[model samples]
Target: MEVYSKKQQIISAINALRHKNQTLGLVPTMGALHRGHLQLVKKALENNNMVVVSIFVNPTQFDNKEDLEKYPRTLEKDVALLKTVNKTNILVYAPTVDDMYDGLTVSQKFDFDGLEFEMEGKFRNGHFDGVGTIVKRFFEIIKPNNAYFGEKDFQQLAIIKKLVEKHNIPVNIVGCKIHREVNGLAMSSRNTRLKPEHKAEAPFIYKTLKTAKQHFGIKSANKVTEWVEKRFAKNDLLQLEYFIIADAKTLKPIKRKSNKKTYRAFIAVYADDIRLIDNIALN
Candidate 1:
């Protein structure tokens, strides 16, 4: 239930835990805690002797300044949610941007082996660079035995796995499941920004994704893409930005069947100004 804002304090705390022979787990988040994020914390608690949840809205990761500014920051509520965990070993490392970047806010370019060139990377230029930079910094600072991330950011998850592999970072990267609302809308901090009507319509995104998953094997990849596109085109509130069926690993768009072990339906939609993303495994 403890919180540390400064780098030295968190470092010292982790050192004390290490001396106690405690294994550390980390959940990196950009505040605005929702049930989805708490699910990640729950997984971390189950595995590690001590868990450090780092909540920092990293500026280097946002390609759009407006998007960065509009991103939610509910630190007080976030801490309250964490406090309800009933676990004393869980602590929050809510550092300031200055503490993270030391006043030099810039993203380092990374070679994600072409994994960064598709979907989110193509749309949000340098987005992966920002993600890589902040994630790498956290790994260096916390030096935890394990780190957890949700599969909602499937592409980001893939790139991070590559990041660890290429850099040989000595930590296990665990990808947790995507949590959703009752109507099937993927839980997100951005969901708070949705207008009432848009909130009602948002569940359709997941509905279509589920229906698309059903069509996946029967229809061709390209045909399934078209079906999902048409479904969104009829909606007035939600706009489909990009929908692609791809090899889950490389993220290369799949126009036809391949020998790859996995394929996934990746999507991004614009619910007016708020952009939401979700993915489903298509086997």
Candidate 2:
């Protein structure tokens, strides 16, 4: 696999591929590659003629400086892992922060049609705006035929879909399934920072979600939320931030039965210093 740090070289290379009528696919990721990320690469390779994996830890997306500082960076290892993929045609774009945003400034704010004011949006403050800025910039630079994103960040995926729609970006956005550990903990870069003991208890997040999903239709939304809160409270290691059953599409909290609309349970919790988020369909 060839690795390019310069934007012009990668763009020029991709242009050459376009000349040959080779379909291009993009997998955007912050490094410290895990099985969850590799799954995206695998999907891209299967359908597209050539795949470009961009490893950029976008600074604009992080509202908390400490969170940004602590975010994992395993570039060398990440590249080595990408090489292990079965596909022969793969390029890795590992750009520096300046490489992405040297002279460019994102002044225009995006309206995700109130989709941004829900769970993650309510907490992270400018998080999705930062996400939109970097992603839009990448789309401009790469201009791939299709882009792959994991469903792990479901809300972010929804906002990105809106970003493409409002801007009329000419690429298909594909949301792959969420990958989890054998123990049910959602795979995440932050998992590396979990203390050994906390790591053991981390699976409880998924366990609680499964329990909530089971009780979803049987019990009221408030009761299910209360049960999850109490479950986390029982263990001091896991701190519940917010847990709500909401319309899967709008992400607005649901207090009563909706016969037509699909609902999902969205959750955020702090396992020690590492914050993890997960959601499950209730329909």
Candidate 1 local lDDT, 190-264, one digit each (tens): 999999999999999899989999998788887898898898889999999999888987899986786656899
Candidate 1 lDDT for residue 179? 99
Error of 1 at 232 (Å): 1.2
Q: Model 1 off-target regions past 4 Å? A: none
Error of 2 at 230 (Å): 1.2
Q: Can you give the TM-score per candidate against the true fold?
A: 0.98, 0.97
Model 2 regions lying over 4 Å from their true place? 103-108
- Among these predictions, the greatest lDDT belongs to 1
Candidate 1 at residue 106, lDDT?
90
The deviation in Å at residue 195 for candidate 1 is 0.4
